[model samples]
Target: MVIAVRTKNTQTVSDYNCNGRHVFTQTRELERPLVGSILQSMWGVSPTHLTWSALHNSTLVDYSWSVGQTPFGPFSEMSTLSFAQKDAARRNVLLTSLNYSISSAIDVLDSVAAHGGERKLLKHNQYVEFVQRWSLFKYKLDKAVSALSHFDFELALYYLRSLDHDLYGAHAIVYHASQELEASLACFKDPPFPWATVSVYAVCVVAFIYVYMKRDKLFRNKRKQF
Candidate 1:
C-alpha cells in the first residue's frame, strides 16, 4: 500500500497574478518572426517566404516548398526557404530562448561604454563574436533546407535533422530554425571527449606502452643471459 501527498506552491493569489506578462510575452513572440524576416531579407531570400498566421502572431507559415525525385530518391517537399530564414531562425531562437531583446546584439556593443567590471565590460566584445558565429550557422542551415527540397521524404528528413531539431519538432520554431539552439548559447563546448573515446584511447596507449616495455625487457634478458 502507498500513500499520496500533494502540496501547493507557497505563493498567495496576489503573487500569482501578473499585469505585464501578456504584453511582454506577445511582444516577445512577435519580435521573432519580424526579426526573422529582416534576417531573411539580409540574406537575399524573398520576403514572401516568411509568413505569419492571421489568427495568432506566434504561428509562422511555411509557404515555400516543392517536391520531385532524382538519383538521390523520391521525395515530398515540405518547405522552401533561404539564407535569411536560416539567419532569422537562429536570431529568433536566441531572442526567444534567452530573453534577449532584439537589440541584445547591439546591447553587447553599447555595454563597453557604460563601464563596470573591467573583465565584465570587455566581455561584451566576445559576445559580439558569438552572435556572428550564430548568424553564419543560420546562413548555412537555410542553404541546407533549400537543397533538401528535391529528395524523397526519408532522405530529406535526415537532412533536416542534421540542420536543426526545432525544424522537426512539433512547433518547428514556427520558422525554419537551426537545431543548435541550446549549443549556440554557450558558443562552445569543452571537449570532455566523452568516456568511450577516453577509455579506448587510454587502453590503446597503455597496451602499446606495455607491449613495447615487455619486448625491451625480453631482449635485455636474452642479451644478459647470452
Candidate 2:
C-alpha cells in the first residue's frame, strides 16, 4: 500500500488520514534547491528546478497495485513475500535492460572496427578519445554490475544511465567518420585504361617497321627511275 500526502505547512496540518492502509511515509520539502540536490544525489545528475514542479504534478495521480487478494495466511508474511517478489522483478528488469544495452554497444563497436579504414577515416585525436571513452564505458558497466550484485539498484541504475553521454559521443564519432570515408570513396574515379590509344600506337610502330624493312626495294626502284 502506498499513501501520498501533500501539505502546505507541517505544523499547521491537523488531519493525517488514509483509509486504513499502512503508511510508508517519506517526507521532503517542496523547495527547488532541495529537490534538485536530492535528485543529483540519487541519479548523479543535476536537474533543473522544473523537475520539482514536474514531480509535484506527477503526484496528482493516485496509483495503486493489487497483491492478488491477500492469501489466507499471516498478513506480515504475505506482505514480505510480495515485497520480495516485486524487488526480484525490478532486479530482473534492470538486468535485462543492462544486458541489452551492453550487447548493442558491443555490436556498434564491432561495426566500427570492421569498417576497415580507421587510419583513413578517424584522426589520431579522435581515435584516442574513442578508445578512452570505450574503456570508461566498460569500466562503468563493470561497476554497475558489481552494484547490482550487491543489491544497490539505485547505484547500478545511475551508472547505467551515466554511460549514455559517452556512448552517444562514440556513436557520433563513428557515424561521422564512416560518412567521410564513404564520401571520399564515392568521389574517387579510376580513369579507364587507354586501350584505344595503346592500339593506335602499336599500329604506328608496326607500319614504321614494315616500311624500314622494304626500304631497300623502294630505293632501288627510285634509282632506276632516275
Q: Per-candidate TM vs. native?
A: 0.17, 0.46
lDDT digits (tens) for residues 84-135 of candidate 1: 4454445444334223322443343344334442233323553454445446
Residues 66-180 of candidate 2 have per-residue lDDT tens digits of 1232211111112222444445556776787698778878876787778875566578988988888788888888988999998888898888888766787788888877776
TM-score of 1: 0.17
C-alpha RMSD (angstroms) for model 1: 29.1
lDDT of 1: 0.40
lDDT of 2: 0.61
Q: After superposition, how far is residue 161 of candidate 1 from its true place, in Å?
A: 3.3
Best by lDDT: 2
Q: After superposition, how far is residue 70 of candidate 2 from its true place, in Å?
A: 6.7
Worst 10 residues of 2 by lDDT: 70-79
